[model samples]
Target: MRRFMKLSRKTLGLLIIVMMLLLSGGPGWARTLTVSQPNQQIYQEANFASTPLGAVPQGAKVNLIRQEGEWYKVDYQGTIGWLHRQAVPEAAPAKMDLSKMLFGGPVKETGSDEVALAGKGFTPEVEAGFRQKNPGLAYAQVDKVETFGVDQAQLQKFVSEGGLNP
Candidate 1:
């Protein structure tokens, strides 16, 4: 009975230690990610519109602090900042022998238009297609509007006058 009690206490103590270690989230738990894309900017905030803190060059390693939406809070070169998720490449999919599958024969890899346009928000081909379908629309006026730009001073003045946050 005494041996059983001693064993139970030892097991309980070990379990508690394991639980504490997991909950503490020490340096061993830190996940380091490499910056895969060039011209990656670390923003003061998670948003792209926010002022950029610094630029993290390609191949630089960053420690991931946390993630928010499409942004990741990272510590790069001891400077904590928010980096876009696009800066890191996702894990590659598992390779499989398609030729050995039930379908038989070697499979040739092909890319569809949908796959090409998957992550592309707006493309020239989409614009051309839209123009073709709606010829009556005044695209020239829209293009002219896009060409308009406001100087920094004027933009700041406008924002101040409108009581908007910079």
Candidate 2:
């Protein structure tokens, strides 16, 4: 009876340890997600208006800790942070290709195609066409503007900092 009691207690203790380990995600499988947005903001709290921890660029991998509605708790760069579900995907999303999808290859000098897509009246092609129409037009300065770009992030800092002002 004494031997059986000791063995039973030992088995019970081992079982409890195993259960605790499994329950705490030690042996459990972790669901990892990849940030799909060009910039994904990590929030200090689950709320969007909360302080931002930092930003994670597209294709960055994050361990899914837990989910609360539209917000997700993720472990990114050894830091626990909250990210909106829209900013991440189960798998990395394919980046958008404007030249291929919008322009359909080398666009014409008059970039009417970009204007149609961007709703902006100006593109390098449009400027070039303007220069052609009027050779005296000094558009070289304006052409340099198109080279600059900014990343739009779905994060608290982005929201507070005026969110991707083009």
Candidate 3:
């Protein structure tokens, strides 16, 4: 009976140690996200109008620190900044490079301009073709509207005047 009791206690102690080892890694673990959008700017603040701290190209990995509304606070290449949620896919799967795994070497890097152009569905060529088809389209008005922007202070004042939550 004494020997059985000793063995049971030892087994229980080992189990507790194993469980602690497993759970110890949980809090420190960070979720890594790959940048899906090219020229994704890491801003100082969550707002787009804020100064850009740096930019991460597509396929770059960022460690998610936390999320605030539509912004994600991330650490990219040791620099901590905020990236818009649009910069990453909703549920991006980890991409494995078989060639890199087999043979250790750097992967071919894609230019930021190329990646940005690829993501744009409506290219200049496409726009020209559309304009040719529809000559009466008001492109000048569209350009004028695109130039209009509200500054942060003005936006806040407007929100407060309307009694809307900022």
Candidate 4:
């Protein structure tokens, strides 16, 4: 009878330890992301707390370290970069149709700059970077980003018009 009680106590202790481990390990598995935007840049030794410093180009992948609302914390090479959640693409279902999704949502287009901007899904980070680097223009002109809606040929044409390398 005493031996039975001792074995029961050991089992219970083991179970408790396992439960504690499981409870403490909840946050171990975190979501990671890779860059899907074209010509995006990752800082050499900085972090992406809310937004990435420069654009992370298309097909450039990274692991997501953390997330806060629309922003993501990511690690690439030895550098940490913040990327917008919308910019991150899932592993499966590879392609995206930007034109149909962007301007068609709720907001009606009056053919204004805001409408054009809305259709492109352009972020302030991208605009600011281009503005700082590419001066001598009234504004940064994005042509091919709008072609994200169509097939590859249209996209290629758009990129060419905008003089985008990719």
Once fitted onto the true fold, the runs of candidate 3 whose alpha carbons sit more than 4 angstroms away are 1-29, 92-166
List the candidate 4 regions with Cα displacement exceeding 4 Å: 1-32, 39-55, 89-166
lDDT of each: 0.76, 0.69, 0.76, 0.57
Q: Considering only N, C-alpha and C atoms within 3 Å, which residue pairs clash in candidate 2?
A: none
lDDT of 3 at 56: 95
TM-score versus the correct structure, for each prediction: 0.46, 0.45, 0.41, 0.34
lDDT of 4 by residue, 19-133 (tens): 8756653343354466665655554333443334555667776776655444456777666766655565333221223334335655334455432333244566778887889
Clashes of each: 0, 0, 0, 13
lDDT of 2: 0.69
Cα lDDT of model 2 by residue, 1-166, tens digit: 9999999999999898767765775322366787888757999999989999998889888887776656778999898989986685343221223344335895344534332333234655787787788987656666787666655554656667885544
Query: Model 3, 65-101: lDDT tens per residue?
Result: 7666667888999999899878985533222343454
